[model samples]
Each structure stands twice: as C-alpha cells, then as structure tokens.
Target chain A: MLKIMIIGATSVIAQETARFFATEGAEFFLVGIPADKLVVIKDDLVARGAKRAEVYEADLTDFDKHPQIIESAVQAMGSIDAVLIAHGTLGNQKAAEASVEVALKEINLNLLSNISLLTLLGNYFEKQRRGCIAVISSVAGDRGRGSNYVYGTAKAGTTTFMQGLRSRLAKSGVAVVTIKPGLVDTPMTADIKKNFLFSDPATVGKAIYLGMKKGKDTVYAPWFWRYIMAIIIHIPEFIFKKMSL
Target chain B: MTTPLNRLKQYKSWGRYPTVEHKAIHQIHWRSDLPDVNQFEETVLPYGYGRSYGDSCLNEGGILLDTSYMQQFIAFDAEQGLVRCEAGVSLEQILEVIVPCGWFLPVTPGTKFVSIGGAIANDVHGKNHHRAGTFGCHVTQFELVRSDGTYICSPTENAELFRATIGGLGLTGIITWAEFKLKRIPSPLIDQEKIRFANLDEFFAISAEMDQRFEYLMSWSDCLSGGDSMGRGIFMAGNFYDPPLGAEPSAKKLKPFVPFDLPSIALNTLSVKAFNAVLYRVPLGKRVRSIVHYEPFYYPLDAINNWYRLYGKRGFLQYQLVVPLEGDNEPIREVYRRIAQSGEGSFLVVLKAFGDIASPGMLSFPMPGVTLALDFAFNGEKTLKLLDELDTIVREARGRVYPAKDARMSPENFRAYYPQWEAFAHYIDPKFSSSFWRRVTASAKSANGQ
Candidate 1:
C-alpha cells in the first residue's frame, strides 16, 4: 500500500482528507498537535474505511523536532509516496494589529513553519527522487487586499516557495504542487459570509487528491477559481487597490 | 512453341510496380497468390501497397513477398463494430466498402495507400493521436506467422510476441491477418475549426485549450521563420462531421483516385513557404468551424495524386520525433533552430500532443509527450547529415525517432529510444527480415564496433 502522511490531522480538512486517502487504499500517518483530538480523528478515519491509521502529536512551531517527527512517521508506515503539508493558523487580522507578537505568530505558523517542514521533506524526497509534496495555499495569496493581506502575505510566500521547489525537483522525479483555494467554508471560515462563493473542506480535499494523480503543478481548488482569479488579479492596480475585496 | 526456349525469352513482357523507395521496378518471382510464395519463409519481407517511404519494403535482393492482392474481408460485426480482414487490405478499400455503411477505420496514417500489415508494422498515428494514442492501441489482435511456419499468435496467447510484432517493424514475423476494432461514424466528413496563432505562445495556449473538446488536432508550422516566429503554426481541430438538414447528399459522392504523378518541381521551398503563409494568413480568427470533407481534413495532400513525385527523382525523407513536456519548450526551440539554419524548408510540419495513454507495444513510439513530424526532400549528402544531427539532439533529450519513417537513424538511437529493444529482439524470428531491419541492425552493430 502507498504511505501518505497528512500534517495537521485534527483539522476539519484533515478528517475528510484522511478518509479519502483511506478509501483509496493508502496507509495513513496522520500527524497533529493534540493527542486526544488525534485519537478521535484516527478512529473516525478507520471507521470511515481507512485500512490503517497512525497519529502523532507534535507542535509544528518546534522547528528542531520536525525531522524526528517525520522520520518516525516514515518508519511507522513504509516508504512514503506523498507528503501533504496542510498546517496553518488563520489568526484574526484585527486582533493581530493589537499585538506585534500575534502578527509574528501568524507569520510563523502560516509561512515559516511550513517552510521548515518543506525544507526537511524536500531533502528527504530529493534523495528518494520519487514523491509528491502538495501544499494548500489560499486564493487570498493571488493578490493581497485590505481584508486579509496579513494572512494573504504568508500564503503568498508559501506559494512562491513551492514554485521554486517544483522547478528544482522537476528532473529528480519529485513533484511539488501549490494548491490555491478560494473562500473555503471550514471551521476556519465559519463566521464569514454564508452565501459567498465558497468551497467545502471536502471539495478542496478531493481536488488536492485528484491534482496529485494528474501531476498538475498548480491547481485552483475549484477549477472556476483559475479563471476567477485570472480576471481578479488582472485588474488595474488603481482600481484593484481601491476595491475592498 | 518448344522450338527454342531462348528465342521465346526475347518476347517476354515485364510489368512495372511502385516501391517504397520511389523506384519503379518489375517483380521477379514474387506474386500475390499464396501458393506461388514458395520463396517466402520466415525470412521474407511481406509488403503491401508499398507506401512505407523508406527501405521497410525493399529488402535489397532478399525475398519480398507482395501482399497487396490479399484484400478480402473475412468477417464483420455491425453490432460490435469489429472487423477481421487479410493483411493486404488497404484503407481506401475499406473506406469504399464501409463508408456507405457508416463505419470507418479506428486509426489511419496520413495516407490511405497503406496496407493493414504496414499499418500494424508502423503503428500509424492520425490527427486524433493526441487523444487515442497510436494505431496499436486500438488493434484487438493479429495472427503472426512465425519462423516455425506456424501462425498462432493473439493478444492473450504469446502476448510478448503480439506487443513486439505490432511496432516490431515486421521483424518478429509476417502478419497474415488482423482483427481490429472499427469506429462507427455518422458520415465520411469532418466538422473542422481552423484556429491561427501568430507565435509559439499562442499556439501552445490554443492547442491546450482546444484539446479539451476536439477529437482530432494537427498544426502546420512554417519552418523557414526564425526567432519569435520559430514555432508559429495554424491549428486544425475537428470532430466527425454532422450534416445539417437537406445537406447530406454531398457526403455520399465517391472520391476520384489520383491516377497520374505531378510535375517534378511542383513543390519547391518558395512554393511550399508561400502556400503555408497563405494558409496561415487566411484563417485569422478565434475559431472558424465549418463542414469539410474527410479526404481534405484527414488527408490534405491526397488531393494531388503521386504527390511524392513532386519531391523529384530523389524521393523524400520524413523525420518524426517525440520529446516529453519537461515544462519547458527549449528543447523543441533548439530543434527548430537547427532545421531553420539548415535551410531545408519542409512542405508539411505537424505538431500534436501525445496524451497520457501508454503504448502496449514493447517498442511502440508514442508516449506521454509532444510529437513533431516534418517531411524533407532527399537533397543529397547534406540531408542525411542534418537528420543525423537532429537524431543526436533527440537522443540527448531522452527522446526517440519514429522507426516507421526513419531510414538513417543508428541502432544506438534505436536502443536509447526503445529501452526494451533487446527484449523485442528476443522475439525476432531468424527467418523474418527486411531491408529496414538489416540496415538498422548493421548500423547498430557498427556503432557498437566503434
């Protein structure tokens, strides 16, 4: 069976993502921060039809501990075919302005933490020369606006870093995909607009699953987002900067 | 009549036949009748229609068994759309009988002159190659006559031999007959959309977008242009024609065959370049969808019968190669640069996307990549040298030249392209050989000698 490790397994997206990979006959290495929540998620994944599921509790902010955590995961499950990096904190922008520490924490969790994990995974995957790294960035990164510029900036950096990694690892047989999701309605975005153009966490998870198989370099969560963002980002700067998106 | 057999020899008459090498010659003892094929064993090269543009047919004094007269359909299942026929049958022959019945060959090469055996041997690709893959992908099964003089090979039994034989260049054995899956169509016509692009970037974007809907796609490039216009071409995307009310009569007319060869200098660089320029300039729009006949859409050059004669007495060499899309167009750009510098203007340059479907043949040509095919007249020693240089480029890029259209590629190039060549060679019957096989193997041996 193919070994797949999903970082941040207790998250809402991870629940559906784990279940999807399980039904596809993959052995799962679900990693999250909390032990009790991971146990419940693991049971849910197996009850939903996972062949085998293992959970690990590790804080992603502990950069030095990532290597061992990943090594243990790879050891628990046999050779890993894919690494899904789906860990991030969507801190409230208004609250972030109250404290510089909070703003830095948002950047650390969203950008630096994912970069550290990817750097470690990049070296491992490059040596193996055959694996996939699927990163979940948001469409907010397509262009920074007043509404979510802080979160968008972090995602933008993540997306760019993935592009560079994709180019470097192309000939080595390792594929790096940057998934840009638009207005996803998860617990992460529960208080946002109800009738807004938004994709569910399951829909985004399925898109990621299919995009990896197709070897697409960058995928918009819902394909319409490709054209939607194309037009949105192409508007003149004067007009785009004035609009409160 | 028995007075003097020597005196009777002076009155003997000989009839000329066309060959793949563009040479007209008389057949010695070889005839179509199977009983008269005592000279034919496993070593003999069986040729039909003689449209292979290279030495695949002429074995250079070796036994050449003519299979053109083996044209007869054994069975046809209208319900399932399956066809079983002798190897000698031609596409034109099938079209004549089946077009009225609303059936068509699943895959066809550029020309209708190819035989069923030649099609299987070459594993021909058509406009729809991007979506459907190669000819071997659709072939259900074929009966191969092996060295043991026993014909007992199908897709399931002797599976390796079946895979090797399809694109094996007739090296494994003689293909006596084949059963293929036929495609059912509304009529012998096409609904085409001509989309023109000013430069390479537009061409790439247009082709990728059109690939979503169209079943058939082919592009024509102006090889004479350089720099920004290097890969500038026109894209022709089409699907099976759907006739409008009260307009079905035109599709029923039988196409007249081209009986005579054209003038020698009819297709010069200036003429072809001018023709391509006009073709590229005429269709200037997002999409121009219209009703067109099948002969023009699928076989555009077939309008001029004996079109190869236009290349002069020297014949022509077709170079076809496929390179994986490594997310960069630099390799393709380099090839076009080399060809442009060579000052050899090709009459027809076709570019297509080879889809995700893998080839079943151990040595089949098409893979998940982008394929470029061009035709050049044999302009003496320089033409061969230019092709060899291009072969080197392809080899370095981990790409391969199509064996069916190749006459000059070294065996090293063959091995590099088909990693399973040794495995394919294991299935080769000693009794079966062709001039194409001898030249390639000898070239390979010499390369190894060096």
Candidate 2:
C-alpha cells in the first residue's frame, strides 16, 4: 500500500482524493486546519479501507510550521510515497481589488503557503530520491479573468512553481503532478452558478489520483479541460482584455 | 437568510414532473451542525441525490436540508461485510470501494446515483428482490435526526422508528448515518442469460423457473405489444461469476454521455416504437448467454450519463404499479392492455416479479406481486389522465403504486394499498412534509369530507 500525505484534508477535492487512495488500502497522514473536520475525514479514510489514517491540525499558511508538519507526516507513515496538496480558496476578487490586505492574505494562503510546504517536501523527497507530489490548480490560472483574477493569479503562480519543481525533481525520480480542474462542483464553488460544463468532485478526485500514479507532469480533470483551456490561453490579449469572461 | 449556504432555490425531482419553490435550502456538511426538523420555522425535508423521479424528494414552500454534501463513510468491517456511511453517500461511491474487495450492495436500484438515505426512504427493490428483498431489509441501523433530537433506530432498538423511517418518504427525520450488510461476490462479473418470452404466461413460467436458480431475475416488455403478442419481451437472469485474477472491474471512468436534451418529438410514438422495435430485436436468434461485467448487468442505463435528457426539459412521469398474483395475472395484464390501447408507450417498460419477502417498512411499496413500470412523456393532462386509469386497474387488483415514482396517485388508492398510512402518520415529524404527502393527504381528506 502507498503511504500518502494529504494537506487540506477537509477540502472537498482533497477528501475525495483521499478516498480514492483509501480504497487502494493506502496509509495516510492527513493535515487540515480544523481538528474536528480532520477527525471526521480520518475516520472516513479508515472506513474506506485505509490501512492507517492519522490527522494533524495545522494552518497551511504558517510557513514556519511547514517543516514540522512534513516531519510528523514522514514519521507517521515511515516513508512517504505520495503527497497531495489540495488546499486553496477562491478569494473575493472585488474585495481583493479594493484592499491590498485581502489580496495578500489570499496570496499567502493559496500560493506562498503551498510553496513553503512544497519546498520542505522537495528537500525531503530530493534526498530520498523517490515520491510523488500533486497539487490542484484551476483552469482560471490559464488566463486572468476579471471575475476572479486574484485567485487565478495565485493558481498561476503555483502552476509555474510546479513546472520548475517537476523539472528539478525529474533527475531525482520524484514525480510532480499539477492538476488543473475546470468548474468543479465542490463546496468551494457552491455559490457559483453551475452549468453543463461543471465536473463533480468524485470525478475530479479519481483523475487526480490516477494522474499522480501515472507520474504525469500536468493533468487536467475531465480531460476535455486541456483542449478548452488551450483555446482560452491562446485568445488574443487585446480581445481577451476587452471582453468580460 | 441570504447566505450562500442557506439560499432559496427552485428544485425538482428527477422526473421534473413537479417543480417547487422552496423557502430556502441548507446544504448540510456535518451531522453535528444539522438543525432539528422542528428547528426550522418552515417545514424541513432532507433531499439527497434528487434522483427519486417524483415528488417524494420535494417540499414546496419549505426548507430542503440538502444532504449531498454530507457524504462520508464512517466505518467498515471487512470481516463482517458491513458498511457504515453517512446517509448522503451515494451507492456509486460505496461501490467504488467495495466492488474491488469482493463485496456488493445487498440490493441495488436501477441507478447507483441514489443516496443510501434515499434508497432506505423508498425501500427500493432490485431485480434480485425475489432473493434479497427491499434495500431496508439489509439496513442494520440508522440515526434519525429530528427537531427534538437524534435517535438511533434498528430492528431491535427503537424498532418502530426503524420500520417507519424505511419507506417513510423522509417524513420521520433526516437520516444522519446508516449501517448495512453487503453481499460478498466472487467477482465483478455476472453470468447473464436472456430469453425472449412470447406472452405473459410464458413470461411468468420463465420467471418462476429462473427465480428458483438465478440470484437476480427481471424482464423488459414491449408495451405496444397486443393481441397474442401482449407481454412479449426478454427475460433476463444473472448470477455472480468467478473470473481470473487478471480480470478487473470495469473502470468507472469513460462514460458515454448525452450532452444536451433531445427534442420532445424525438420520443414521440413513431420514434419510441422504432427504438423499441430495434431494441427488442437485439437478442436475435442466437443463444443469449454471455459473461458480462456487473456494471452492465446491474446498471445498464448508467452507461449513458444524463440519459434522462432524452425525456426532454418537461420530463416524463414514470408510472409504476404492482398487483399481487393471488388468483391470476389478469389484473396485471389489464393495466398493460390499457397502456397499449392508449397508444401512449414508454420507451423503457420494465416488468419484474417481486418475491414474497415482506419489507419491514410500514409503507414499503413492494409486496409479493408483479410490478409494471412505464415512462410516459409529460403532455400535461393527457398523461395524467392515462395514469389515473392505470391506478384504477391497480386499485381493483389490490396492488399499490410506488410513491417514490408517483407524481399523481389518488389518495383513495394509496389508502387501499397501504392501510397502515394512519399508523405511519403518527411517526411523521410534524416539522417535516413533502409535496407528495400534501397532495395525497389533501385529496384524501377532501374525498372524506374533511
């Protein structure tokens, strides 16, 4: 069984991804912000056939605590086979535009915090020379939409950082998977009006798990998002800037 | 009141027969955070999956406690083959974890999209009902959360609540979590056999013989068949098969999809007849025995995601009724004859014989009878009138219609089929009500001069 560590275990996509691994009888060290939610997810993982599921409550934004969290997870599992980073938020774009404080707070949580954890994990995995790291980015990162530019920018930063991390870790035999999901019907997107294009969390979760196992560098949930995003990325900047998305 | 978590929305059942405007909808994430049925100023009804196909899952001008977000597996005992999961967990989710481990649901409905809670509430039956009984028979226990407090109910503990909650249409309370036994299967493949029967008597004879040996038994009838050809269809039976270790469960991914709604004209008489004709001819003259994956054997319709879109935006009313086979199946034949004569044909006409195992639910729909289910495109009054006629035939036969699939069932017939409605009513949380309950009760009260 694979020894997996899931950061932001309480998030809908993370919980679903954990369940995918749990079904394979994997060992898990779950980290989330809320202790209660973590306990619930941990119990659920065990029920889904996880050999072992342990949870730690720690805010992912606390950069200083990243090393300790990674250490605890490694100690709990003995060895880490894979790590899934699925904690991020769709911050209020209007509020972020109005105040630098909101923008910085979102960036810290969605981008910087993840980079800190990745750095710590990178060092450990580089030394060990084996493991897989997967993170959930968004289709919004392909192009900045005025509606959610702040959140999009954070994901864009993470996606680029993952590219660099994947290239650096390639020689060391560590796989870095950047998962870009489009319009997932998760609790995070509960407020957003959904259409036919929306993907279910369960579907996205399976894709993330399978892509990580296959050692893919960049994976798109729903598969169709790859082609859709390709067209969106190539839209002329002058026309894209003038048109509201 | 305007919070994203608790916002007013218009919701409809899978049938899309009746759309109701609810005061608000609260998507429950944690069982601890669930409000009591009485806690809401407006009435509350727990809605799961929204695949009930009728008004049973809907509440008008009330609060719908959406439980889809409450999905979580709590505990599982591999040795005991028991699974405990939050009520919102879908059968599809459970199958993902258990199927690979040589375990399967004791009873599964046509689609795996329905939630565990919804399955229990409807006390749904599968083709193997002749062997396994309704879904509730396998349910060991479930916690019912009400306005007063949460209560644990099982066969031996708070047994009345357990009986009432099953097939209670979610009136008793919101089921927080449930534990049920899973049947152990040797492999994810089924040894399937399909035989075409010429008439109702042949169908019955074939079913009786198959039920004695097969683990699962069901049939599909061409509703347009009449005269000597009436009830002519294919009888299908399956048993679990052992496959080689290299043989894997069909990957859940790669579903064939129906991207958009088909025009209403696409399901018209000419089109439906054409489709049914082609489908009925599929078996041909060859011996219809094959080793098939459990996915196709159990959930053939699931192959096409959103196949319901074929019914169009107006949706179709799925009229399903069961009549006991005490003397003969004349009453059952009469119901089919009326549908055939009316020229209102359902694309999917499933005829199955229910086994004699009585469900523990007070208002469970299935009994020792033959059930005929048909989907009539919603053409307003025309379809409703046709359904009323079918109900009359069912009432005369002493069989009842399934409430979970009914958008329109006369209260008189419902009372006749389930005389235990008055007894079941006492257990209904006053804080809970549904559009189906309101429609049936109000009509019944009016008929009784109330």
Clashing pairs in 2: B37-B147, B38-B147
| Tens digit per residue, CA lDDT, model 2, A1-245 | 89999998888888878877887789999998789888888889898788989889998888898999998987888989999998988888999999999999999999999889889898889999998999988888888998999999999999999999999999999999999999877778877876778877778888888999899988899899999999988999999998889
Total clashes in model 1, counting residue pairs 3 or more apart in sequence or in different chains: 3
Residue A186's lDDT in candidate 2:
74
Best by lDDT: 2
Model 1 per-residue lDDT tens digits across residues B1-450: 000011111110110111333122222111122433334543566666656666666565556655554444555566677776668667775665556567888888778877788888878888887777878888888887765665556678778888888888877776767888888888777778878776666777777788888998888777778777777878888899767777774663634432112123445545766766766676657567776678777766656655666676667888899888776666777888888899887878888877877767777888777789988888877888888888888877888888777767777777777778778889888766766677666645545424
lDDT of each: 0.72, 0.85
Candidate 2's iRMSD: 9.0
Cα lDDT tens digits for candidate 2, B135-161: 999999999987777899999999999
| Deviation (Å) of B338 in candidate 1 | 0.6
| Model 2 vs. true fold: TM | 0.89
